[model samples]
Target: MADTAAEAEEKFIAEAKTRVSFVRQTGDALSRDTTVTQLVERMITHLRATVDDPDSPVRPQTIDRYENTVAILRGDYAGGKYPTIGDYPLSEVTEDLVHEWLWDVSVIGPSMGAQCRSAMLRAFDLAKDRGVRLWPVNPAKEAKLKRAPRHIARALTVEERERIIGNVTAWQTPRKRTDLLSIVRMLADTGMRPGEALALRWEDVDLTGAKATVTVSGTVVELKGKRADGKGIRRQPFGKSDAAYRTLTLSSEATTRLLERRVSASSYLVFPNDVGGVLSLRNIGTRWRKARGAEFDGVTLYDLRRTVATELDRKYGPAAAAAQLGHTSPAITGRHYIERATVVGDFTDALGTLR
Candidate 1:
């Protein structure tokens, strides 16, 4: 009787182990079969990271923009079918869906569509990286944009730059507007973004140095328009690439101008608002609009950045231009920011000479 009981007990244990093994196999299968919704949720969660910069989290403005792309996929702003692309199966999602979505948003504007497509492509690529098998291929790879979207085409002419400076200088007041004229001039000369220029501390400027240097590290921005995570931070953190941190040597003319325009602000910013808050983009825009008086369509403070890019590209080629602009790759400066080939003289003369 004892031997029979032991044999029964051993058999029962073996059966239980078999059942556990089967359950484990089932779980492995289930894990591999993650749904499309699960994959995208993973993608979204993963993207909420500091990919933009190493110093801090992704800039809030950028997060909002990324979220907007998700919204675009969901048929939010820039209308498309409800229960949109996100509702579909992962393997089932085709290039056609991406192309269609791009086309759908194009009705709103090419720029909006381009931004949406670009964002979606990034997410999809991320999903593939996470072992999701989210797509056999990135559909966006084949989806060609029919026409290039209109971008900022022209740099500010010297006369236009002078006029903007003159206007800003004439329109300033103790409270209404302050120090914007000097900031504009600095941007043109040094290729600093307005935000970078505004965030500059007096200590960061070395007027005493033989080559006047402005450290291009910090950026100032109002928090209201950006993502929640970006709020409460006084200065927008620098984005990825160590190249963003560098010393920019100012021209003799720029150095002289900076010294003349420098002020002792309580905020210690080289350029500050009347009350010494970082000069906001909103304030700058309001003042520029009023100063220009006419429809100076397409002219903005950022154009000054482009103006500097054009000058650098002209003087030193794209690689040197990229270095001055603090880009790790010259391709970015050459492709996006720097203006291509100046039309110096009549091509007809060159052609005749060649003949």
Candidate 2:
């Protein structure tokens, strides 16, 4: 069937090469020593590389959180005394080993354990999708974690809001107290996240008209690495979600506070720290703790935003509140932010008819 001996030889060599390639692939699959850590690292590298892409599935905050979870797995979190299985061979990892790791992390906090479990689940799936076939089954999928208790937010009363605003003992410095008051007021007025309020600049606000408007263009966050200027915390130039970027009408009180601060403002930030940098959330928490003393241990600065959401939901609707809070859906606002009403529609007449 061959045209010549040379042609026949060439066909034979081609078939032989195909068989060799198949054997090599099988051998590699059996002999590969890829570790769980390596797979996670690959996924993390990909995520970090494509995090800025508009089509990237994961958000920037998600990448940061995933990295933090990886730190835990590497025993590098905090003082490196945590649970670790980074060196375990991916093919050898069992469901029991994963369960043990999850339980160990749960000792720190159930919420933290849940977060780690979620990251691991995603990492394993991503790795598998990329043609990494080290594992027969995904160990992360088999792992189980106890459900963490959800924190239900209650709207602060008007009296509580006023007290938080007037608490002078919160900050020893008069300037800090004033800044805290303004920040609290802005959060209460607009239902904006604390980070959004902190990231605000003079350019984001327009007070020329009777009704002042504030643009929600960005948020303050602490990234993994320090920037060229040696600062870890900076404005992220975007909000948590697409809906977060919106323009809101400022209340008269918020407008007044901004105007007063603008007269003496030296920095571009609406709420700069003592060092004129973006006001860190840690500083805000400390001041809030000082102000609350022991009576309001459960109340947080975020509750102010929740309080605004509740008010808006009660006055207008969930849709309106969702818009004010920059939520993509009213369902999220209703389920998480707004407290459930104890009473609803009256069905007494219908019940009586049925009876």
Q: Cα lDDT of model 2 overall?
A: 0.78
Give one clash count per candidate, in the order shown: 1, 0
Q: Where is model 1 more than 4 Å wrong at Cα?
A: 1-42, 49-60, 78-83, 125-131, 150-152, 221-234, 239-241, 260-263, 329-331, 334-355
Q: Pull out the clashing pairs in model 1.
A: 53-240
For candidate 1, write residues 51-82 as lDDT tens digits.
45445434555555656556655667546532
What CA root-mean-square deviation does each model show from the true structure?
9.2, 7.3
Tens-digit lDDT track for model 2 on 128-203?
6545556677767777676666667689888887776666335446555336767777887899999999999999
Cα lDDT listed for each candidate: 0.66, 0.78
